[model samples]
Target: MNFKPIPNKFEYLNWQEIECVAKNKRSTVIWPFGAVEQHGPHLPLATDSIFVDEIISEVFKLFSADIPLKKLPTQYIGFSPEHKGFAGTISLSSNLITSMIKEVGSQLSEMGFKRLILINGHGGQISLLNTAARELRSVAPGMAVFPCFLWSGVNGLSELLTKTEIEDGLHASLAETSLMLALKPELVGDDRPNEGNKVEIPKGWSLEGNAPTAWLTDDFSKSGVIGDSRGANESLGKNLKELLINHWSELIMNLMQSDWPNNS
Candidate 1:
């Protein structure tokens, strides 16, 4: 049986039906943005991409079921591999990732997709994605491309999370570990240890400091974890997932209706 939902037409539909749906529906496309990154010893390397895909799949189902909304014009998954370092991490350069997103956005705009939602999974790609969104907006004035981080946009879920000593959630932390367990329990490891070290970049070092700056996971933490993952559990993961989906759904609806300023 063909499991592919959006791309495969025969099992779910045909090209003609897809075209008709696109023409009749409000033209919006959902892009699942993901990264090939290391997730420690226990988890699979494609953890980030896999999780993002799963989230997008669920969101598609929700839209189809509850909203019964017209099918979106287009939906696709894109990947960048710029984080390749810790054994399984694969990454594209920041420039390449930005350009790819811009091109995709441009193509979508040309296809009359006025609204594009980028469902991003990796924390490291946020800056590049932000830049890409801005460029896309400039290139396509009437098009609106909104980029959202799945882990960050969830409602008050962050406040509910147990705090760790680290400033920001690191490579793999309670939140991510919990998410993995919730999404892909088989991939989570039982023997891996958690890292609770504080983020200590060199003095005056900032994520926005300057170009040519470079650092490795070893420079930050010993176990490649930036926060505590010890307390993460399946229940928390489920709660977080629900919170994210609900919050994101609301946000997407708002964005679809909001007006884009001419000068912005």
Candidate 2:
């Protein structure tokens, strides 16, 4: 907001200050997109939002000294039609989410912010987000709209998150639980027996990665957990948080003023 990029909270700044910064095209805006959906029995429904919020906070803290980046308020509800059967899961239509993202991006771009990044935590809406990003390409013309998952953007995430978990896991899995353990210990309740321990994931039932197909959470899991959370620990969570922060801080700082990569 101050444009000084030091000891300043962007969210606290007034519209005049924000406009001044935006006019300069000197800062990047990061919007965290997540969902208010069920995260099994142990984790809060706001798991995705909370995780992204913490990651964005740390990324900013890690980058504040070196870069001009503004953190926008998070979008707490997202596309989660797959989790419909689960109680308390508020799923916005894919169309709604994409349209909203496009609107936000266009508004920010018109304000003269040359770069807009969507740091998404929820996986269900990723495809739609890509569409939103592409839509902004036309609407915003010269602005760079990037939609990405924090873990996927990390350098060595495959080493940290196994292919099995990344592929088969959907909710309340090892990765999400471990992250919650690190960031919000109190919110992570006891790992009830069989939670995330369903031996058979079944055919046509998966959330992310190279899967044969996708299915609803209630189609297979009774506990709403797709993998074992027993193995999660605070240490792993801490390590992951540090790794993510370091990786994003470095990558984002270097790319602040550079052109977007050739890859989509």
Candidate 3:
């Protein structure tokens, strides 16, 4: 096969297409950040990437009318420091993630792009991401870089959180499993997860509760799962995607019109 790159729009845009976008549009690039960490036996290690891909696609679809944004291939390996005990977990160092984002943003800035956005799907790397965003703005102040998490601004997850108990409702729990089921059913391996060698956290333990504790996944859950995945279904996942699309569409529309400091 004569490969000429993944010839398409967004992630695979050719230089010529990029030039066109640069000249005619308030150009932005969306990078999907994820992790290659364990997500119980039911979900694949690449689950985060799959979720992010959908997020990137939906953002472009919903917000294209407001601004033209190109999607980049998902950064498949992220900072998963908390998951080090897992066999397949591939975590990057904070310095590396931070430096990589800045370097990429600087290059994009040189390419005449005005904005760079990272739509991260993994919560394990939030600290690194926060640092990356700050460093990008400080080092390349001329380019507007926004680091956003897929789960942070979802209104649809509100009720889900209340019912599912978000404190432990993360990881390979109901919400994440439901999303995986909706997006890629074939890869749902076996939704019936059995607790592995993990030591379960306290019944009422909360990740967000005001507890002065420092622990990782192995210290808490027996399997990689933290919340109940008993009720995960396609409908729940579909609803989340819809709400996320709406939320991101509105967010990008505002970002596109924001009084960006670097906008000329």
Top candidate by lDDT: 2
TM-scores of all predicted structures:
0.78, 0.87, 0.86
Highest TM-score scorer = 2
Higher-scoring candidate on TM-score, 1 or 2: 2
lDDT of 2 by residue, 162-241 (tens): 77666655678888898899999999999642444354656765445367456677877888887777778898888888
Backbone N/Cα/C clashes per model: 8, 1, 1
Candidate 1 structure lDDT: 0.63
Misplaced by over 4 Å in model 3 are 1-11, 63-67, 194-206, 209-212
Off by over 4 Å in 2: 1-10, 192-207, 257-264
Off by over 4 Å in 1: 1-25, 65-83, 199-215, 256-264
Candidate 1 lDDT by residue in tens digits, 123-237: 6677678888998899887667777777774667647685442245556777778888999999898844566355545776643335324446666655566567777889988
C-alpha lDDT (0 to 100) for residue 214 of candidate 3: 52
Better TM-score candidate (1, 3): 3
Ranking by lDDT: 2, 3, 1
Candidate 1 displacement at residue 256 in angstroms: 4.6
lDDT of 3 by residue, 46-151 (tens): 8888888886676676553425567777899998877888889898888889889989888877777778888888987766787889898887777778888888
